[model samples]
Target: MKIDEAVEIVKPHLTKSRFEHTLRVADTAVELTDVFGGSREKIELAAVFHDYAKCKPAEEMKQFILECDELPNNLLDYHHELWHGPVASVLIDREYGIIDDEIKSAIYCHTTGKEKMSRMDRIIFVADYIEPGRSFPGIDEVRKAARYDLQLASWMALRNTIQFLVSKNATVYPDTFYAYNELTRQINGGY
Candidate 1:
């Protein structure tokens, strides 16, 4: 879908603040797409709709997660915030006319990430975290890493996420750990 169509489709589903953040993420994703090489169309759509399910009712998200066979059951056990990725992906794929597997997977793993993410997936993941709406410690470094090396940026972002979660005594999903390990290997082993 075109950016304008995607925006019109997603804007009503999000609050004003959330829509603005989505726009920023879309812009950032497009930039990363240029730097890292991915479909700008896919990046913009995935980034704009990435958080479509973020503000939905928890009971609704839980029901969708249960009915959706593609999503792992463990997603229901993670922090509720993590549900948006998979939920949005499923909903968009099923109803929003977005049939691309890469876009769906990018949205699916945007929060926790995954072991092997495609270029669009990596772009969405990092763009979401380092977007202008986000302001966390070490984000600057991750942004720089994103510019230089997306895999290194993924490792850095995962490390920062793990540390943040650990500090809060929150659960760190296994996929995130796997992503960190895989990215580490890729970066260190010169993959």
Candidate 2:
């Protein structure tokens, strides 16, 4: 799908800030794609749709997870903040005929990244985390690492996420741990 078409499709569903964040993510994805060499078209589309379900009602998102065989039901057990990415992944395919697995997977894991993430996945993941609008402690370091090493940047984001959740006594999703461990190995040459 064209970027404009994708933007229009997602625009109405997002709040003004969220919509701007999505645009920033798309631009960031494009920049990262330039550095890392991936399909710009696929990454952009994935970035556009990454937050498509962010504002959906919890009941609606739960139903999507419950009814869709592709989405794991265990998602409902996690914090609702984590549901949007997986829900958006399935919703885009069902609602818009976006059946490209690369785009779908990138959207699916944009929240709590999975193990063995594709280059497209890392791009969208890092793009979303380091988008210019997002300001947080240690973000500058992640953004700096992103300029040169995608894996290291990804690991930094994952580490920061894990540490944040631990500090808050929040439940860290298993896939997040998987992503962190995999990237740790990759960076340390253990993979």
Candidate 3:
């Protein structure tokens, strides 16, 4: 679907503030795509719908997460905040016919990134984190990292994310750690 149609379809899934954030993420994803040589269409779709289930009632999100046979069952034990990514992918695919694997995986792992991230996955993931609307410590560092190096920026974002989750005393999904390790390994010499 076109970006405008995607936006309208995604609108009801978000609150006004979240919708604004999603817009910034979509715009930022475009920029990242330009920088990193990714598919703009895929990145836009992933970014626009990444947060589609983010603000869903916790119980509702958990229910969807629980029912998702494809998702790792361990996710059921984690907090609902992580449910949005996987659940959003399912929702968009089922409701809007957005069944593109790249877009779906991008949304699925946007929150807790996977070890084997595609270029598009890294773009949407980093774009979502360092989007213009976000205001957090070290954002500028991440933004700068994103400018010239996708792997570097992804590592920085993942590091910051892991740290944030740690600070919150939250469960750190293993996929997140795997992504971090893989990125760090790639930047360093080798395994």
Q: If both were scored by TM-score, which would come out higher, candidate 2 or candidate 3?
A: 2
Clashing pairs in 3: none
Quote the positional error of residue 167 for candidate 2 in Å. Answer: 0.2
Best by lDDT: 2
TM per candidate: 0.96, 0.98, 0.96
Candidate 1's displacement at residue 185, Å, is: 1.4
Q: Write the per-residue lDDT of candidate 2 for residues 97-132, one digit (tens) a residue.
A: 999999999999998999999999999999999999
Off by over 4 Å in 2: none
Query: Would you list the rank order by lDDT, best first?
Result: 2, 1, 3
lDDT of each: 0.90, 0.95, 0.89
In candidate 2, position 83 carries an lDDT of 96
Model 2 C-alpha RMSD to native: 1.0
lDDT of 1 by residue, 16-109 (tens): 9999999999999999988888778878889988998888988999998888898888887888889999999989988877888998999989
- 178 in model 2: Cα distance from truth in Å? 0.5
C-alpha-based local distance difference test score of model 1: 0.90
As for model 1, its CA RMSD to the true structure in angstroms is 1.5
Give the lowest summed-lDDT range of ten residues in model 3.
64-73
